[model samples]
Target chain A: MSQKPEKLIDKKGLRLDGRKPEELRSIKIEVGILPNADGSAYIQQGKNKILAGVYGPREMHPKHLARPDRTVLRCRYHMAPFSVQERKSPAPSRRDIELSKVIRESLQPAIFLEYYPRTGIDIFVEILQADGGTRCASITAASLALADAGIPMRDLVVACAAGKVDDTIVLDLMDTEDKKGGADVPVALMPNLNAITLLQMDGILTFEEFEKAVNLALKGCRKIYTMQKEALKAKYESVKEVEE
Target chain B: MPTFFERRQLVTPGDLLAEGTYVTGENTYKENNKIYASRLGLVEYEDKKINVVALRAFYIPKLGDTVIGTIVEVGFSGWTLDISSPYLAILRASEVLSRPFRPQENDLAKVLDVGDLVIAKIMAYDRAHDPRLTVGEPGLGKITRGQVVKMTPTKIPRVIGRKGSMVSMIKQETGCHIILGQNGVILITGKSLKDEQLAMTALRKIECESHTSGLTDRISQMLKKEKAKQKEEIKNESKT
Candidate 1:
């Protein structure tokens, strides 16, 4: 890895990715990509590419793991060995495990798990490329896949990250900015309900900057909410086109 | 007193269908005086009630419905069957044979071995236990000499059409014995391989284009074209 320049933002207020201070990376989302899986999605956020597959509300194995009252949610977050600049090991790392747990918890609030008692829904997310904000992008793709699988839910989950770079608070940091940045905060929300599902912060930030960063991240999440809804609605609209 | 969206309006989960004095039906839940869609489906407003019809979903077994199942495991007294649902269906030896008792004397596997296909009826089911199946009913027993086609449960209704009209058309045209299962399994037996192949193509076409309009007309046209093409090929073969 190489060190970034001392100044992440220029006097013109543009970051290395040629983005404004509050600009997010380009996001692309597609649903129902994997025919075999009950539901699947592919997402691209700038240079980061992620694929998510969902199966279940089906039978749970090792019978004892089944929840008597509600459906159990299982999530696996993995980064491909060649995803990063350096070749990483294929084994699940501590960070991967932690991210998986957090992503599952973040999506739990949106699902109506009580509808499928004694069953389990499995979510698998693999990052084929990494820039930054992979966790947020993973959550976005997973939620779409869940909806694609026809699982009942209260709302879709949207996520975004904001960080302070070079003493300037910025939205949606890239890899270089994240490595050299200060106080990276990732936020997940249920946009329809205006509720936050996951909020985690690392590094240093002052009280005012923290508040600003959270507000910026929430705004980014709302923007993502629109994209997610469009992706889902597009699937049905295509059928309507044929009807006419 | 109730307001409803036009039929076939697409809705995603959690989307608000309406907010008023109205009765809610399947795939729609009411919360705080507002009705919300619970599935990715089409909205239907019926006689003062609102509901969303799911586009695709897993099959939920219901009592007294005949189903096609494959035996996966055999116990001392019953056989474990996979009905393509989340729960495993149980078929007892008594249900397999009309005669009573003597589980200790006869081997259950002999009657229906693992991997054998059977057409059975769901006798009972609830949240606590697996559904019980029975094969003693007429036309319900081991399924042999037919090709089975699996499809999405939601598309099953479209394939069957209203009052079995769609399916009967296919059977009449192709001369295949068609058994429709609510759980997305169809058994088709024809007089010859050509007849079976014709029916298969028609059914697959229906499944793929289940959401479109005027599908019955399209299917009938397709069947006619297929028959004509087959006759042309046969004439060419004779000339050669």
Candidate 2:
């Protein structure tokens, strides 16, 4: 195995992965994959693989934590031990807990929690493989799982990450680029409402670059939103044809 | 200036449904004279009202609906039942058995202990507390025999068919007594093991092919074939 060259982007305006600066990695989504959970979904983004399961809008356990006015939303973001090249721990790490909280908050806006008052909705996202931007992919998968579970929501949330690498703004950075020390910005949005639900930035960027990255991420999110809808439609349409 | 999506059109959250002078229904919200779908589902237009019927979802409790629950805990006066909903169900001792209960002499747990399945009706419900259940009514109470099957709550309507025509057909052909819970629990009682297994298969077929048309005819054909096979087996056994 050879080390990656210092130059992250070629003079031809392409990245090492042969993608343009503004191009995103390929994404694949499937819904209703788990039989046990009320709703479940799987997503593949480039080399990242994630599975999301949703349970409840049913009872809330540890009864003390139950909210009286609206349904409590609990999210768990976990990485399988085999997800990384080096085996990861099965237990929840500090990073995992923080990610879970952010992910849960990102989704709370889209769901109509009040509709299922006093109940709880639990979302579990497992990272089977991690390339880069697993958080964004997990958020996307969790939202789809929630939809599959038939939870009422104001909108579906879509997410994408953008980064500044080699002095150029790129959409959907890969694991290699992410490790090269750059400004990575992950954004989650309610695409139809054009509202940003989650945003996190690491490294540094100029004001102009930040604005451009956000716009690029939003555009990428819209594309993801379209794909999500298509996946759902394909599932339902096939069922319809069989019925017909 | 009312707008509408075509009947049976699939829509996702934030997709516009109708605008102006239209009442929004389930899984829909209105903003600035425009109604939008609040979830992924099929659009419905009826009686000048637009609604989105969700394709899948968890079951929420409703008053007067029948349910199949397992006693999870026995309290002083009531039992906590798991009805497969997010909200637990509470069955008071008074409503559990028809006979008068003397707390000093009769223990509620002895009558209906944990892990026992009971068929009950939702007698009362409120959002803040667990739904109240009653098993004293006829055809309700502990499930002494039969197998339990679960399906999607949304598909229960299909299982029942129009006014229970489909369920009755399954019972007549398989000779199985089936009780369908609105929350998607099903109890099937058959006279023989073979008949019970056949009834379960027929129920599963409905669960799988529920979206298709002519299901009633298809189920009837499947059941008729099974009956013929059973008759042939009986004849061979008698000959021996």
Candidate 3:
């Protein structure tokens, strides 16, 4: 384990990665990468690599769990053993279960589950590499996969993290900033609907700082939302070109 | 009086298709007099109605649709068939048997065992129950021979083309009998394996280029070229 650096912010007031306090890390997204999956997407945000696959609006296994009047969404969030610096166990850890539940809840609001009664949509998100904001990236990728699968969604969900590092709040905390930062707030938003789907905070933040962090995270979400739309359309660019 | 996008324009979830009492259709939802796309698809306008033609999607069963399916389970009085949909379709024993159905005397598996393929019609479908299927039609029964090729359900229209041009062309060119299932399953049978494969390749080309314009003509040209190539190879083999 590396020792925590004494200064997370440089003299120019930039974060350790030379990003402005309100700037986000680079993000790359691709859709329909897995043939077997009904829908799939891969996301690379900074050093974090995540893959999400969507299967269904199909029959639910263990039939009793299916609801009579609405479709059930099942989510699984898992990290590969080598995702972190140390080898994490492949089994579903407590944190993974909690994240899976929260991510599912975050995504539920966007889908029109009532269209497919008694069926199930399974979203599987695997963190092949982790930096700090795996959950947020996973949500972003998983939502794209759902859209790619042609599921009815009111809007696409996008997420980002903001936190206080070296007494200065920053947009999109990296691993070093998250580990040593005073506070971290992860927020997911449906940009079109202007609704916050998920919000989580850890460590300490003053009320004013919390508000700033959330607004900053929402700003980041909105920025990523445009990229999300582009990625979705890029998957269909061939179709569009041929139409023209 | 205003629409946000052009007809057949690519749209993703949350894109505004139109506003002010535009009746929403499939893959679109209305919110406060505004119609928005509910998935990734192309905008389609018919009169005052707005629908999004999804590019990739699951097969939702509808009444009177012909489908190819594999029998997954032989139940007591019916067979559960997978029609490539979220729900399993039920092919009742009574629908298949001409005589008065006596369950005790009948051997259901002997007729349509599990794993056997069939060309069936969706007799009924509703949200309340699984789709009911029937194989009583003359051309819609057990698929004895040939291969089943699957493509995206949304691409099936391209296989048939407009007014049955693409499919009929392939049928005439390859001498292959092709049955297209609404659920994206296709069954091809021909005099020889080579002919069947030609049909499959032509279908695959259609699936890949379904979005392109003038696909019917292009596919016809491709098939003609391949057929000529195959004949030349055969003639050379005879000489050798």
Best by lDDT: 3
Write down the TM-score for model 2. Answer: 0.92
**Model 1 chain B lDDT-worst window of ten:** B1-10
Q: What is the TM-score of chain A in candidate 2?
A: 0.97
Regions of model 1 farther than 4 Å from truth? A235-244, B1-5, B101-104
DockQ for the candidates, in order: 0.56, 0.62, 0.68
Whichever of 1 and 2 has more DockQ, that candidate is 2
Q: Which candidate do you rate higher for lDDT, 2 or 3?
A: 3
What candidate 2 gets wrong by more than 4 Å, as runs, is A1-4, A241-244, B1-4, B232-240
Q: What is the Å distance of residue B4 in model 1 from its true position?
A: 8.8
lDDT of 3 by residue, A100-154 (tens): 9999999999999999998999999999999999999999999999998988899
- For model 2, state the Cα shift of residue B146 in Å: 2.1
Candidate maximizing TM-score: 3
Report the lDDT tens digits of candidate 3 across residue range B76-174. Answer: 898999999999999999999888888899999999999999999999999989999988888999989997899878888878888988899999999
TM-score of each: 0.94, 0.92, 0.96
User: Candidate 3: where is the Cα deviation over 4 Å?
Assistant: A238-244
Model 1 over residues B89-204: C-alpha lDDT tens digits?
A: 89998787778848688888788899998998999988767789988778999987988898877778888888978898999888899998878888999999898999999998
